[model samples]
Target: MKTTTIRTDLPREEKRKGAFMILTFFGIMATAGFLAMSIDLGVVAVFKVRMQNVADAAALAAAQEISIALDEISDQISSGNVQGEVQDANSYAQDQARVMAEHVAELNGMFIDPQIDVLFGQRTLDENSGEATITWGVSPFNAVKVIVRKDNPSQTAPDAKVDLFFAKMFDNDQVALRAEAVAYIDSRDLVVVMDFSGSMVYDSLWRSDSIDKLGQQAIDDGLYNIWTDLDSPTYGNMQFDNDWITIPSDSSSSPKVSLTWKKSTVDITTTKQLDYARLYFSDNKYQNFSSLSGQSKTLSGTGSNSGKLIKYAKVRYKENGREYYADFDLFDYDTLKRGLDLNGVNYPYPSGSWNSFISYCLNDSEVNRAGYRYQFGMMNLVHYWLDAQMPYSSTPELWKTRHYPFNAVKSGGSLLCEFLDGLDFGDHLGLVTYDTYHRVESQLVPDGWVSESVDIGATPITDDYSAIDTIQKHKQAAHYYNTTNVGGGLHEAIKLLDEHSRYGSQKTILLMTDGNANTSDNNWSVPSDFSWNAMTDYNGDGVADYTTSDSHKLYTFVRVKQAIDKGYTIHTMSVGANADRDFMKAIAFAGDGIWVDVPGGTTVAAMEEQMLQAFARIAANVPPPKLTHSESP
Candidate 1:
């Protein structure tokens, strides 16, 4: 009591200092409280940002999964494997979407179960506001919507709570967050135009049997059998079938062979037996011998001994105890052997046997005639080589037989089928082949679209598999033909896409060829007057004037331009050496698409691989599903 009595009499300065301390203590407490509130808000803000990021990822993942699920269901329905119900399909897609969302959310630090929602539908433009609104229960089921939530109290399984540090002083333990995203799959209509021209059948390894035999002989003999002296003036007389007529030495004109007499060294009394006989001939025809009396006389010999009888006239001579014969045709022996002597055709003495000589001339002539003229037709060495490589029945018509290298079209078609198998469900595909004419093998239909024509009991196409099956059947039935009609194929492709493609879908043409446009007329479906250039009104009078005819390339260019104007993109692929790269590139450029060149290879397998790679590349380049919207609602 005594110590507290004098406290009120302190100086004014001291009292003021004490009051300031009390106010400062209250102010410090207030500042701490405010700091704690800010900490809490900062923690909540960070958590919201993190949760929003997670929601975006989850939504995108869920949307993609839903799209895939819907595609599977559509494929099943189109394949006839299942009669798809919109409700069941949507339910399945939603389940997939939820699973994907939860999985993605968990990957992004969401430990507790996150709230997820999915919708399968279409996005349509609002006519009034020009805004897009997602509408559910639409045919084709091309759209998906996903919503992800964190710590949402309304959700049965809310997202994991975001713990607070400094905010704990304020009793704020966690925060709630949510995000939504919408995704849609765009429809694509694609047409594939293939070229099946005559050149498509060309194979470098293709040879005839005759050529092979001659080539083998040349290899064995170490000499090229081709006649190099064919231009020689005496070459015609060397022919085995040439008629040789020689006149006796006494005949006027000129003697082809002159006679000379020599005294016999051993028998001087009998004199050399007409040592050598000489004969003369006019031109290549036989000249009658005129005796010393100026009377015409013919000398002939008969014998079945194997010898090439060049001329009808023959001369006989006696030596020792044997009689020998010589034909007037033998007079040309010196000239014939002049060039052939180096090879093996040897004419020994004038009385030598002609057996070997005859055989050599006949074989040489056969090889020369057949090899130089390519007279082996389909059975030439090329054919023989092809046969050895690819065995088949030795049918009369070899070209008609299907073989490895010749099956390029089939291989290409098979690759196309493989590509088709990978197409997204709901994408429409059309097939067309061009030669002298263009044929629509298959009309544009959804990737899941199927027909009883392909498989009677097959389930409607519900997915890409059935669509691929349909395409496979068409490919199998396709056959190669003669001319390349690019314009006709393009025309048919456009018609098919226009007739069967759904509105608002992407239209594309996959044009493949091994050659340039070779046909001028569009004889597929259009009339003659409306064929190619005839259909274009160049003067702008709206009337097709046939004044100037258009080339195949120009006509095809026009068609490509028209298709491009109609919102069609053309992707062109060239195969083999004959393919026109520039032309195809031009078409692709005009159509606003890509151009692929599938180079030829040394081997059939290599070629097939190149083709497969080309097709795969094209498939990969196909327009992918674009996300029109990727934001939370």
Candidate 2:
């Protein structure tokens, strides 16, 4: 120990030992630095983990909120009535977005201005593609990549990736949410009513080049095409004019014809109240005008006496098993060229008419030769044709016919006598006149010749007699006025149609018209003093009680309401410009039907195609109503 102390004093010489000490100190410092780095790295790792968890939660929360928002959006869109309201949708959507964003921000302790930026809605979903798009706002980072798609996660991938912190590098972060959805709108119910009336026949104006400047080819072609396709057995067809007639493809089959006269009469009155019933319900103006407009709310006398009488005669002809003519008979080339000389009122006949008329007797060519006039058996053939083509009372006016002028003769003008003569009574067909006019004899000719035995009575006799007399009188009044009543035809046809229909089958209606309701001196009721320019007889007295304020509008209201009440999905088409577009539109709007306006300037082929397309559209949109046993009843 004494020797060591002596050496320590001498170490003052060893003061140059600074290098070794420095080395030792530096090594200690290096180790401390390594430890400090390990601690800092650990802290960074923890922060990363926390950030990831927040991102996951935020994304999922946004996704769910968006889904709810979509549901709200859909409800809002469909909430408004047909009038169409929209701002409500935007408000609801934005509210939902804010709530979702706030909740996410609270959980993560991150600042965010969560909201939805409503954009103009201009896009429509591609239903076939199953795709939708939506626009939204961005916050914090200004922009980010995201896919806003439908909520059907089932269609999404399980390992989908969503970046939450990528935008954080810009010192800004915000949860952006989006979603898309689709809802279906449907309109599906249909009813079709087809018109089968006498006016469907070709008139001289529809044929003559002089009067019919537009040409007959169009009408002829269109009608032919339409009729051929409509003749299918799968659909319902009725032949109606002032009455209902069933033209069976198979003569032996029970014709699917409804006797509207009887049915309508029965619907309004029974045997006991016939005479006591308000022979005049509402005043004449109201009652008559109402009937003409297809309203007839008061249900005056049973069926129109004229309609019933026609039906009676038709039934007789049917019972006798007579044959009627097809519509094409009046247009044979030869018969058409021969021209009609109705007391010097020369009129060109359509070639097809003559051909059609002859179709009842010999082959179609019998009337093809130039100046060919089949007079020998023409009356018999015409009678056969008349019997076969009996019209229904409710047939649409477009389908009815009145004065069928053949060979332009003043004769062959009276359809009433022709109707009765076609019956099994042979020449006794004139007996109906006898019943009405009290005739002892039955010899009446078209040339104003009456076999003394056929002309007996003067005063009106049976109702049937009176009805025929009306037809005769109409035939003599206005040449064209004698044309058929189409609405009446449809009414009759519908009645007959019910017979063949059973419950559960689809019921459809297809109505075709050439013009509006027939207008005659505006007298829907008996010609009275007040109704010379009045509308209705509300008092039920025979006088004109109601004046037409909006009678024209009433036409649409009545027709549409009637169709709707019957549970029919109506489809209406105008044959030409002759129809009232406004009225047609009203009818279509009220019944949810289609209004097809046949172009006036277009070619017949084009017009027909367009009409058919319209028909197809109607057929596509509406499913027929399911027939019920009560529907027929």
Candidate 3:
């Protein structure tokens, strides 16, 4: 504006300031562009992670559904509810798997229906190579692979993609992503080492609070129960001493001598006996007479109505005269038909005082051939629980052949099959029972025997398992007697797994007992000079090394360690109060397994409940579904 008094220094300063302003503007523009690019990249990265999470979650859900559906199909095959094979089951499982995957994907912020691919197959381990191989579209489909993606369209929705928040300016707003997973229902091998000791079948109340009144007592050191009129010495309704009776043939006279008795108090040397005259016709009618009184004359049809004969009477005898004159039963039932069995024993029962207590076992219904399960719980009476279609009747000394606890064990084993079926995986099961002798009933059997005929070693049939356990259990339970050799049982179980277990599968020993370890390999009858507390080697060679309780317990641990050393878990179960608790817990601890003790209550219901729960826990002991692999689709 006004004067032209310009200096050379002022012009130079103005030029420098202009250069500084231009450099600052360029640096600010470059920084803003870089910040925008970084923000767009961050948005894409975050959404990519979220899409991968959704895919993984969806794949897991699909695999889980497939596993559950396969389980249902197996159940249907077992119960004969549906006549379908594993391939048929796979069809349904895959379909539902797709649905489950979509549902899960949606739940995890995937608003669109994502592309899901589900495939059913079997995952097997190569025995020689020790590697797992997945084969698709197999018969026993136990493995499922799921692939979830956002790039493909579904029937109800368009393609799904991870949207970028800050990349819109660059016209790159979305990214396609996918995930995959393979879940295998892994296989397991279990050997049920059960206790079949004689004590397993004791009377339900044998261990009760008020056992004196109704419970059965074990005799011969818990080997058997005679149940010899245990209520009292003065029991009621004994069989008539039929040696005195001379039954006539059917074609006897009109006033036929069908049955007869005479009065002679000789060997039956009770003081005041029979009255020989107090006869009962039935519950409604009875009258006293002296025809069968004095010398020898209680003849047929004496002191009785025509059609209704003497059903019961009291004769005081069969005693060593140590107690009072207690009168017991005399009867005219069909059991008194006076015949010998093929074994030369009395046909219906034994002779005289042994049959003296038979009437106490007989109820009003059994006396009439009606049914026998209600009265006194038919204690040692008849085995028919209310129906004639039930198994064989209860006979003296036949509690081993027919009872509830052993039957409960068999049924409980069947329940294990049910649980195994629920696993939807192929499994092998074996059996070993220990009493005085430990016998292997069956070798490893597959849970899904796909063949028409059941054959072990690789085939499986829940029915296959069912049939084997059925036949073997009955055969072995018939001999549930003598001592408990837990060591021997574990030894057998370990051998079974060692020989039959499949490679890349779990080998497990489920050792069950209702008693302590008593019988070592040797059945000791004579006491050898050995310490009762030490783990003794009687012969000093290490075979049959256990001679006492402590030694037997240690020997059991030694057997358990064989499986442990081979990478197997030993799960211990105790089914009764008398079971060896400390040893069971210790062995389980040593093998890094679980110890479960189910209280053996005093009834069949309780036994059933205990075994069911115990096996259920054992079933749960399997490792959770094997997440075999996860990867990009």
Q: Best by lDDT, which number? A: 3
Q: Model 2 lDDT vs. the true structure?
A: 0.31
- C-alpha lDDT score of every prediction, in listed order: 0.49, 0.31, 0.51
Residue 410 C-alpha lDDT in model 2: 12
Which ranking of candidates, highest TM-score first? 3, 1, 2
Per-residue lDDT tens digits of candidate 1, residues 388-469? 2211122212223333233555555554444444333345556667777786653323322223344212222112445544
Top model number, TM-score: 3
How well does candidate 2 score on lDDT at residue 312? Answer: 15
- Candidate 3 lDDT for residue 492: 82
Sliding window of 10 residues with minimal summed lDDT for model 1? 261-270
Answer with 1 or 2, whichever has the higher TM-score.
1
Instruction: Itemize residue pairs with steric clashes in candidate 3.
Output: 238-329, 292-298, 383-394, 448-460, 448-461, 449-460, 449-461, 461-464
Q: Candidate 1, 130: how far from true, in Å? A: 21
